[model samples]
Target: MNERLRFVDPTALMHLSRGLTFNPLRSAEVLDDVLAAFDEKNGYVSDVQAWVRGGGLQNGPCPTLPSGRIVADVTETMNAERKVLHAAAILKLEREAGIAPGVFLSMVSPTLDVGMRVELPMRALLKGNLPLEGTYTVYLHVLMTSDGRDLVYYGITKRGWSLRFQEHTRSAISRESHRLFARTLRDLTAARARELHGVLDERPKLRGLITTICATGLCHGEALDVEEAMVEKYSLASKHANGLNMIPGGAAGLRAAQRFKGTH
Candidate 1:
């Protein structure tokens, strides 16, 4: 007799009525049919679309139906109609070589000529290491062409120091530098940054600038893990005659609103 423990076997009649009589095969078939119906019914759409349709546009474009709504192709709203990231080649190499984290963060200065090219020389911070432990060092060189269309890439030291991974830079890159670059493009396109620049034209708010920067990066397919922390540290406050309250989700929401409007 252990305390806080009790067990009782059900009577045969009770077990028959409650648990033993059920047909698991039929029950599974019914569940499968329900899930299929749910998927087929287009249940993934949100209520926001319906709400927009219901609300009449007063100051901006006309809103009658799908035709009169202020709708446009979202792809057209992006800087280049699509944002692409190139991690495949680097990932492949890393996989083959069994590289880990915290390996290298070195610089490879480029040579600007008929085309931009760089020859990287990594000092190999760690050697004779296991793959599943820490970050591995991989030398990389990227060049943004003058035309802003082409990218020149070179991955050095895996083989020879000067062997180039031609056109490898065309792959979409996920890095802080790329994040900042995408932010600039979105700001120029959405006119959000320009608006802020015009309004606070004299002395700009530093935190506002930072939030905008982070938000723009998020919009252009980048994520900063500490975004919430950044907002908590930098957002503004409002006070009424009786009391003061912070706007819920302030800077982050503003950024999301801009994103929803295809501004980002």
Candidate 2:
């Protein structure tokens, strides 16, 4: 109901659609409160219901036999909860067992290391988290400095962190760069270009300055869930505006991850 509610069943009040984005917290049976008040008097056949009725569909058996009827069909739905109480419970128990939380993102204290080994600690990310293994990792590109850190962008990746970092660096220098990390580097470089007399160097300037805060213990679906939550929390108003995200988190991540998985 937080977004928009449209259906004529008067009882098929699904909170969010199941097709657009998968809400891990949801299952079909948890949809509605039948006891909740519904205004039937104001309820009239919607455009969808009218279309079905126009087709002269009858509420017979089989699909209608034992009072079975299809009122409407919607394709896209998504939802998120901030409390994450249920997931938190399980993660805390995992922590007790010396396993890492399957969903988490936070900045690490800068090791202040320089040269080639500078990214080693950040690549491993959070310390004290065992079992740094998962198909998908939800990560944050944090702009780190001696003063403090700021979130630059968020993403999910199936490739190992080290490989993904290299992929991003390569993508940034490619002529037709459309990758998220590449785009972010382009944006940052452009900003710097203004001061450097219009020199748009797309080299990986962020190599040492960026620290990745990652959640490395979630399965594919769980990773999508956490990615969806992280993106919503730090979504850009416009592409390259506040962040480099061009799409909403959950559903899109699945498609991208699938493609990455196939390729690698």
Candidate 3:
């Protein structure tokens, strides 16, 4: 198990990633034994198990997550490509995933349609171990245009999305966080030569800013897992060159979650 990260075997970690569904309990048990062996407390011992189960903190340009739209605001359109599926249609998806009815959340928007037609099912069953329901939320901070080329920031929170958005908002508005999300906001604010509040109010009206909910009902571990996957999928890391995230999702999000919710 310890060999998973060994530099000697580069393929070990890749093998882990390629395989879907990790046994968190198994990973946790192994890590516990390893940690006990060296009495290591502040290192990977504390986080590896969680990483194996879940994954990032993205206060992304989303860190500047301004007030944005939700399901209720969706403008039903005749276009079939962007429509959010109704719960009745989602019933089969929910039951197949073994989640309680209505727990698999799906959001809609013409800007960047997020209904079951797209990634709704992808997040839920990333790994066979993923639960259909839990507390934490895995979300995307999106900025898109009519071209639909959107830039995104990903983050997870047990806190209501509003409260967490405020945390990023406060940090970015003050220019305290240098993370990509904050930078994106500051850059936009600077570009318009306008006050932050005014810019926040303007972006959505122009249909350029969007806050997306990927999925809810994730337990701490599952949320982290999905967040990491989102970061990777969206290319949020700097190397991806298109994402607004400076840090990969999971560890940071997991650490924050541990602080707020404890390692239960």
Looking at model 2, residue 99 earns an lDDT score of: 24
| Predicted structure 3, TM vs. truth | 0.42
Model 1, span 1-264: residue lDDT tens = 112111111121121112211232322233223323432454311122232234412233221223121111100011254432111011113332321111111121211112222211110111111221122112222223223322111111222222222222122222233432233323322343344445433221111110011111022112222333333443212322211113313346456657768953
* TM-scores for every predicted model: 0.16, 0.39, 0.42
Candidate 3: misplaced stretches above 4 Å? Answer: 1-134, 145-149, 193-207, 252-264
For model 3, what is the C-alpha lDDT against the true structure? 0.44
Better of 2 and 3 by lDDT: 3
Q: lDDT per prediction? A: 0.23, 0.38, 0.44
lDDT (Cα, tens digit) per residue for candidate 3, span 147-244: 34566788887655546656776786798997777766555534443432344334322224555557665678778888888887785656665588
The TM-score of predicted model 2 comes to: 0.39
lDDT by residue (49-84, candidate 2, tens digit) is 333344322332111112222211111221264322
Worst 10 residues of 2 by lDDT: 114-123
Winner by TM-score between candidate 3 and candidate 2: 3
Per-residue lDDT of 64 in model 1: 25
